[model samples]
Target: MMVRTVLLAGCVSFFWTGPVQAGMPSVSLDLTDIAQLRLQSISFFLMVLLLSALILKLCWNLLAKDFPKLPRISYKGALGVSVLWGLMFLFVLTMISGARELLTPGAWEKSGRTYRLVEDKQPDDASLAAETTLDERRRKLGELRSALFMHVATHQGKFPGKADETTFAKEFWLQPGPLQARYGYVAGDKQADPSEPLAFEQAIYGDDQQLILFTDGAIKVLPTTKAQDVLNGK
Candidate 1:
């Protein structure tokens, strides 16, 4: 009856811990991390083996005292039993680890000294399209800035006072997509402060950020309110 009880307890413990251990996803590790993990596992196994041996020995002593007719188990036999228990524990751990890797799709990453799930950071189709459109707008603004500088060089250091696309060469003015609105140009000459706002998008882009150009020929993506404040000379 006592032997049956011990076996039942062991089975219960295994089932209770198995799923918890198996749920941990496998992680990618370098040589150093692998070595450390192995060392820790060995240490844990040895500790469990020692504790199992001590418990078995204590049980044997109690049984021998309480019931002398009971068959005696030697120290070597107890140690052998502990070894078997330890091996079973390690086997369960190995099975759980293998099951985790089989069930999960991605490898976890090592962050500092710990492991974390690797997240999918690839942008979705809409995000990609938005980014591509933003890039096109930036390129157009760059061309417009170059044209403005060229106009200043030829027209006595003065920018076009009018915001019309015809104020410069026809090819220089490109309409932005989705909104099809022309860039809002501010009247500024070459002699104005280099940091002064010269041009901006007529519409706000994604995340309330707008593309703005300065008299210094610098372009930036800024918040709509802040860009407005700069344009207002605030």
Candidate 2:
């Protein structure tokens, strides 16, 4: 009866999570984030496991005999314990699985959108620092576009002149920028055609697919050599 009750409660939890997850997609967790998540999951698991075991033992001692000693022995109480623990077990298992997916590359793709945008490929010299820098740079570059557009709107359709990350940061009220801009900047006023000139670069890192933000707010990823040509007015 205990096993049957536990299985029924487990099914209910699976149903609950499935619909909730369907309505709200999973967001990938970072390594640091998942570390905390796993700790919580383990604590939850242990609490439920111990509670269920204790309840089952108590129920056996009180009610599992031809002539039970305890008059207060109730099947309902054992059923409640089984159900509660089963639900808890399902929840903890789901959390652990989600955390594992977030920490594992290629695994996050299945889970949903990653918290940190991951590079398509790891560079030959890629390390934790490189990946962290690259992710920060990518996010900053996207954010910088908004500030640049605001500048253009206010300044006769011209972007800020020769600006760096700090300049855009100031423009956007971010105070000090999250990180220095990897790319150089050219004013939007200089170019008539939106696609003609390089607005900014990833010159510092010198990576292929250097992020090139355009005067028209369109961004392109280009190789370093081709990006140099564009910057040189080739």
Candidate 3:
């Protein structure tokens, strides 16, 4: 009987319990572990209690005097106790699991934001020093627009009048933003043969230039926002 109880506890624990380490390594264990442990402990205790009661009943039936009646062991009582134990286990498990998620370090952990900043260090302090890089980029984009307009005016409103790299380079120096250029250009409609993978509208980001100038002449000061957005777009 003891062996059966032990085996039951072991099997149930094994099936119900998850590995000690399950979540993201950096985030470690949270509420789930607590729930698993609680359920296992309750199961173990219930098995032991029932096993003891069964053994006592067997002994009493065999050895007790006829005149001195053995105490009543109602199946109803055992069933009620088992049900109560199960419900209590479930209640505690549910409450704790829910509570742990609210209390534990998850999305609320500000460290995630800190890690993001550390991960995306700018190419230089120059990127950080600018008061408003986006604003500056917006202004530059206007200049590029004017240049594109002029190129079109000179060549009957058509891009790549001759489709020469030097001519296109001179007319519109595709200043792919740091974020956009790093990945490479998206070809514009004007260029019959773009740098490579001719795109209808191109954006260039060259590491050597130390600038992330967009084809639209917008600057990307923070590589994270602009760079990530552009890269993720692809």
Q: Model 3: which ten-residue window has the lowest total lDDT?
A: 192-201
Model 1 per-residue lDDT tens digits across residues 1-234: 999999999999887844554566778656687799888989997787777787898899788888979777876788898888777998998797667767884666668865577888987544543554678888989998988888778878777776663356765564455444577877644454656788887653456778888888888988888888888888
The sequence of per-residue lDDT tens digits that candidate 3 reaches over residues 161-214 is: 232522434424433243332123344455322222211222232222222434
TM-score of each: 0.41, 0.36, 0.24
Candidate 3, residue 97: CA error in Å?
2.3
lDDT of each: 0.75, 0.62, 0.48
Off by over 4 Å in 3: 1-72, 104-234
| Model 3 error, position 61 (Å) | 9.1
TM-score of 3: 0.24
Winner by TM-score: 1
Q: Of the candidates numbered 2 and 3, which has the greater lDDT value?
A: 2
Q: RMSD of each candidate?
A: 21.2, 25.2, 23.0
Q: Which stretches of candidate 2 lie over 4 Å from their true place?
A: 1-129, 133-136, 164-182, 204-207
Residue 74 miss distance in model 2 (angstroms)? 73
